[model samples]
Target: FLPLRGILPDMICDSKSYIDLLTIYQEKARKDCELVGNYLYDLLQKYCSKNVSSKAQLDDLVSIYCKNSSFLNVVRTSELKQEYRHENNESLKQYVEQLPAAQQAPSDGDQSESMMTPQPIFAQDCPELCWYIGLRLCDLFHEKYGRYPGEQLKDIQNGSEDDNSREEMDTDQRQIETDLHDLKLIGKQFLTDHELAKHQGGIRDTVLEELCRYGSCEIHSIAAFVGGCCAQEIIKLITHQYIPIDNTFIYNGIKQSTALFKF
Candidate 1:
């Protein structure tokens, strides 16, 4: 049977930056696990259509999976061995600092390495994809501002004691406009850095506006639906009976539909 693994991260300090970095790392690590599961299932379907094969055949499939899906494409050369340690503490520090300085260049390294950087594929027609892209932008906003968009407005309004003065309203509007403009700037910089600026159209303003208004608040209805879905997916994985999501799963509560994105 294929092995299943769970994350047990290394010891981390109690600082907020480190905590935020851990969250991002965990999200990326979870995505990596899903990618491996999907790749393995596809490989099995391709090789063993009817039933499990001989030990030699299974061994070959494992080797092929390793060669194709190993992190960073490290298996491109059989002689290349991956070393994991705390040798890159400086790089980690830069990464944590990058949240506040979105335009900063990545720390120096071997620029010629074969690394996978998924370019932004913004499609105006796909709301799910656009929403996903907006979520990434929201994450960047959090990194830079240490608060989600609209959060400051919420706090200001809360502290106003229902006065609803013109000055307060104008301040809220100005804050929102500033946040939206900054998000757009960061998104553009991200696209340029990833060489995706030449794409036909960038993210739409409406998407950014919606995300700004959201302020990353958790809604109970959406949370309940997502939680149920997660439970079902976990059951599927444990039972090994039905196919789980391939890679990306998007749920649009507005549209009341779910979409699968395989990349």
Candidate 2:
């Protein structure tokens, strides 16, 4: 939607001073186009029409734009390369030549640690609301029973038969109830009286209550579904250039009760 065409030529002229500027423009255009394609695909069902407007139409537009942009970048880069060649900029030519063949290997420790760390469900600036809820529920469980609920819930979700004792089952249920109580507390702290009344017995209310009372086992099946929805929304925000993302917001969900962070 933005008029990138007008600025492209000025930044991409065949000149030594503009080489870096040209590369930056090309990269930004490629990234912006990809983001647009992704956003359209994710929200197509909600906003697009089946008869006239469709994901396919959006995809086609993105493909055409990308193709043209890619061709233009190639041509521009080639021209720059030619200018360098003419000027006998052998150092720059050698650097370019080495780029395609050179590969960097991570240290052994780096590889091992990277493999062990779980991939974040959302972009670095995107908050994992469900996970935040889960962690808060875990803390509430710990307050009541002096132990985290994560281990027990993990066992149940993983279908581990070894921990199927009656005692464990009862403990798990109690933990869920405690989680539900916490959710109510959270809701009361955040929502106005009218807003809370509207959702008193609704699905959202029920889910929040259940999550607080019982932990993820009560909603483990929907964890991935909820996470994916949040990820989709976050992607839309980033791609649309909606706002500058903050890392702290991603780490901590909206704190309703206090202005200051407790931890």
Candidate 3:
């Protein structure tokens, strides 16, 4: 996992939910191993043709890869607005530019001179941004109810409740609905408490809904696929014979597609 210290603001990274967010996240699995394999094989052939054998040459290659591949680069690519491409390198520029005119960054004249509002790395419509916020909200939900979105109802069902009570409260359908509602509430409160509603607006409901519906379950196939990809990357790191992916890899199991984005 990449350190988020400089990737996100201290206010967010220091929050309790942020810690929990690290523990849980949308699975970013990499697929299409053959594509990566082919790419590596080509690079290896090129390397062999050059007859590069010096430690200095290898160190230069590793440095080049490290510079290009980073978690922050992927986040910036996915969340940055196309129009704001020129401002992408500005450290103080807000990552999310969807704030309403009235809530935008304060002008120099509006400053109190000693305090400034901390800028956040959230976007209203971006899937990557929503996933981060939703995961944190899920953590907040866990903090509040002592159960994840869908687990509360499961616990209730297993409790010593009478049949009538179980019939009323324990249905899977009802639990699904409950989970959705609770997650929405938690999401709203999170935005409000953090004063992000005025900045980036509410997170997309679809992201939260998906999280609630899926709960914490993992598809075994996806898990195995991720493990295999990670192992491959680790081997490449150890061997240093072929260039490994420079950063973010997204795999869609359903689509049978994989994309590698260099950060």
**Top TM-score hit:** 1
Q: Model 1: residues >4 Å from true position, as ranges? A: 1-126, 155-165, 200-202
- For 134-201, candidate 1 gives per-residue lDDT tens digits of 67678777898898876756434333555565467667667777888999997787555544564414
lDDT (CA) per prediction: 0.58, 0.43, 0.52
Evaluated against the true structure, the overall lDDT of model 2 is 0.43
Candidate 3 runs further than 4 Å off: 1-95, 98-126, 152-170, 193-195, 199-202, 240-263
Q: What would the TM-scores of all predictions be?
A: 0.49, 0.25, 0.40
Q: Which of the two, 2 or 3, has more lDDT? A: 3
| lDDT (Cα) of model 1 | 0.58
Q: Ten consecutive residues with minimal summed lDDT in candidate 3? A: 113-122
Give the alpha carbon lDDT tens digit for every residue of 23-118 in model 2.
777787767777778876767756654644655667678856665553342211233334323354343233223323212332345432321122
TM-score of 3: 0.40
Clashes of each: 0, 7, 0
Task: For candidate 3, write residues 1-263 as lDDT tens digits.
Answer: 42122222345355688856644432111122233334555676687757645544454444344333453232223443432233332221243343233234335564433111122222323334346556667888888888777654343333556887556544754676677798888777765555456544446655565666566667799899989999998997799545676545656554465655332
Prediction 3 global C-alpha lDDT: 0.52
Tell me which residue pairs clash in candidate 1.
Answer: none
